[model samples]
Target: MTADENWWNGSVTYQIYPRSFQDDTGNGYGDLKGIIRRLDHVAGLGVDAIWVSPFFTSPMADMGYDVADHRGVDPSFGTMADFEALVTRAHALGLKVIIDQVLSHSSDTHPFFLESRSSRQNSKADWYVWADAKPEGSPPNNWQSIFGGPAWTWDVRRRQYYYHQFLKEQPDLNFHNPEVQDWALDTLRFWLDKGVDGFRLDAVNHYVHDAGLRDNPPDFRDKTEPDYKTYEMQYPVHSKNQPENLAFMERVRALTDSYPARTLIGEIGESHYPVERLQEYTAPGRLHQAYHTALMHKPYGAAFFCKQIEAMFRDAYAGCPNWAFSSHDVPRHVSRWSDHAVTQDDFAKMTAALLLSLRGSICLYQGEELGLGQSALSYDQLVDPEGKTFWPDNPGRDGCRTPMPWEAQAPNAGFSSAADTWLPVLPPEAARAVDTQGDAESVLTFYKQMIGLRQDQPALRAGDLVFLDMSEPVLGFVRGGEILCLFNLGLTEAVIDTANVGDTLLSRFADVQDEQITLGGNGFLIARRLSE
Candidate 1:
């Protein structure tokens, strides 16, 4: 692979949710300056890139995902100067900086939305997705928002119901409008010129909507499950994942390609046709990568992993698929996959090893390396509005957004000097703090070793992945070249035939050569071919 292709092919990216990373100003919220202060810490993890969540000016309805300004930094996240400094610092450490770009919609406070809603004939009126209500005075259609209500919000000013795939305060942009397309593309240029390496495009699949204003069909599945029948649960067939979205993705791709060593990775949310859409969205000259959370919500087991990986390769992502086990929105992998049989730390460490051995690029959520289990947040202490709205039944993401534990003994776990942090700092997490795990044999050390191993073995990073035929509870795959990985998800030790195996390179437990190797429950092994 050329240097440019090498940039993303097998690279490990560290995702930093700025609000929970660190708070330098003591305002109880993390800022860019805090990120700059911790650049050395991130670089120490040996990751190739850093993906920061949005810090743009927003109404905070959905945090920074609902942007009001495309070019300016939010006061809560520090100034634009602070952002530039962060880019400079990260680049100096040989780390690529990828910022979150929410192109699907903007805060209602955005100037485009303000002017577009002012008059139906205004120059910017068509820049947003707007449509007249139904003859019966209902919404344009039955589109539902992800935040638990109708996707269409009635705007009396324009005498129409505009589309909002998320919170009503976040109005969807009209990518169908050519000028609007130009504006969003220009926003990419603005950042690349400012030294950003790439973008994590937020809700990229929802860029285009059904032009005919079609009503969504009802889903017959149970509506009481946590993520089942919420507002976003209604039929999203016409509201999102439209085929027309590809042309605009191509336009965005062309813009990113104009820059050297830059990339675009989209966030696609769809259960049906997700992998298919991934293939189309990234089919060569469109997006460099795209990710869906299908596997994140499933139970951790050999069968689940097999199906997800196979589908990805068999479908659209057969050519290129970035692998991520966890991110900001979903439950942390450790807690989500914890079997009462194993200690939380064991699950966490094993998960890190498993994610690193995947075929495509890897994204590591913050604090995952420390074997950090999810924090338990009480209803009153939750900060995420989503968690608040669905309380008890569907507790939001605040459990995963707790402050990063930096010290096992320090007050507030060394995350903040304030008497109380924005999110609760759990005592269990504090015990596994970075300071405590900096020791040579700590779980954090294991991550460093595994990540370094991936970096040293070019074959592990970008080579083709071939799944090995195995029995239940055993998942196996040979990364192109010489590396073969075997994972045992069973509760009892099982011996595997490695008659063709050569030398052991790394193992979570026991080691073996050409002989039969016994894998402990939840254990894994990695070996290189003899010729290598």
Candidate 2:
């Protein structure tokens, strides 16, 4: 609120996946005007900032992740004026605005890629990652795409194969070229000059790849769990997470540091050493914060979380962490971990408290406050190529990318007035619409309470965490040597002796009495020590 240099520390960031947030144009898709109209809802949540996912000009391959124009907004998402209006309104409500910056790759349809692939002798010929085919006409290497199939796609125009970590429609940029780095930095400068607050760097680790064409090593881990693509079979040692990524990050940081209060939070996807990569990428002279997918992909439980968090902080990275349980790429946390939760609503509230109590910046995906479970979509309803590719085996991300339900009884659940939405809204999500639970004791209200508590308690926000020795199903930790946080991440109720505990600060389905506390299934509590 004070515009401090470290304003992001312990801040609550709300992510709005533009396509599903709101549809103001009656065109069955969300736009910037719709986001401006909904800014009040985000501000009401007591969030410190809002991180809007990619709304840039794209071919819609991999959704907006395949950017066609770095500085232009997609016609489907409104014009630049509309974006500026949204930023103005958000700042008026004392909320910082962060937009997604996808620098790792661009749509193959982009002019740069088009020019690069023209004849291999053009000015932009080296702008993209192109390589000669093997003697047998196979790909340059054995790299695989994250969506599926080979990472390399043969181009007849240039008579060469280009590398793409995702879909073939997306061509990886050759960051080894200095001009490309400068071009990307200029794109960030364009947004910063527009008075934007910060950027969430998409797939930051994928910005650079092994300079030498090399095959990745196989991951010999158990394959009992369902993996959507063969990409997971390999460790991606040569395909991405290259050592040169740190130098590029330093360049990005240098540009961002030129602006006051402008921050950079990088998204580190599934890497061999995500935690270590995050730490290195966010260290001094690099990214201000790095978001790792470890927590998002981890098994749900106290032990798993404790181990992950301990490992992350043990190394002590200079840059802070930006944590989130749900985002556009993954399934909703409530539904993902439903096997361990007694009820979806209870689990949602419990997770909200747990996330805010953690020692780092937090991100809340839109519709999460309403306890929206993943929408069950049929094969035909799926738009995500990844979802269609893995059908029954993986289900892809379409389930979590559905529209947000505003009015339960309204047409299309108030997301749009059109006959159909991009993705179907399930009955469960409609039943938990915003209007239906505004005045009730719902997950939305619980989020507001938890967020307010975090804003008021410094210990809960930027405190040092010390795990407490508690029995199974009861995970306890002390923050800043004062705030004691406890959770029962199981189906059965659990009780813990609270001899050192003091006055209750915030709680959900939990009570303390006679130096003891009883937590219901999927319950949580935050207490402050009297001695402190």
Q: What lDDT does each candidate get?
A: 0.82, 0.88
Candidate 2, residues 1-532, lDDT tens digits: the string is: 5479889987889999999999999989988999998889999999999999999999898889999999999999999999989988999999999999999899999999989998979899999999999999999998999889999999999999999998999999999999999999999999999988899998888889998988899986777876657898898888878888888888888899899988889988865677788888888898888785777864877888888788778755445888899989888998889898788888898888888888878999999999888899999999999888988977889899999999999988999998988888888899999998777578899899999999989898888889988878888898988999999998888988877777788887787887888999988889877782
**What value does the lDDT take at residue 271 in candidate 2?**
54
What is the C-alpha lDDT profile of model 1 across 446-502, one tens digit per residue?
898899889988888888788888887788888885788888776677788766676
Q: Which stretches of candidate 1 lie over 4 Å from their true place?
A: 1-5, 220-233, 315-318, 511-514
Candidate 2 — worst ten consecutive residues by lDDT sum? 310-319
Name the lDDT value of residue 318 in candidate 1. Answer: 49
**Candidate 2 residue spans exceeding 4 A from truth:** 220-228
| Ten contiguous residues with the weakest lDDT in model 1 | 223-232
Clashes of each: 1, 0
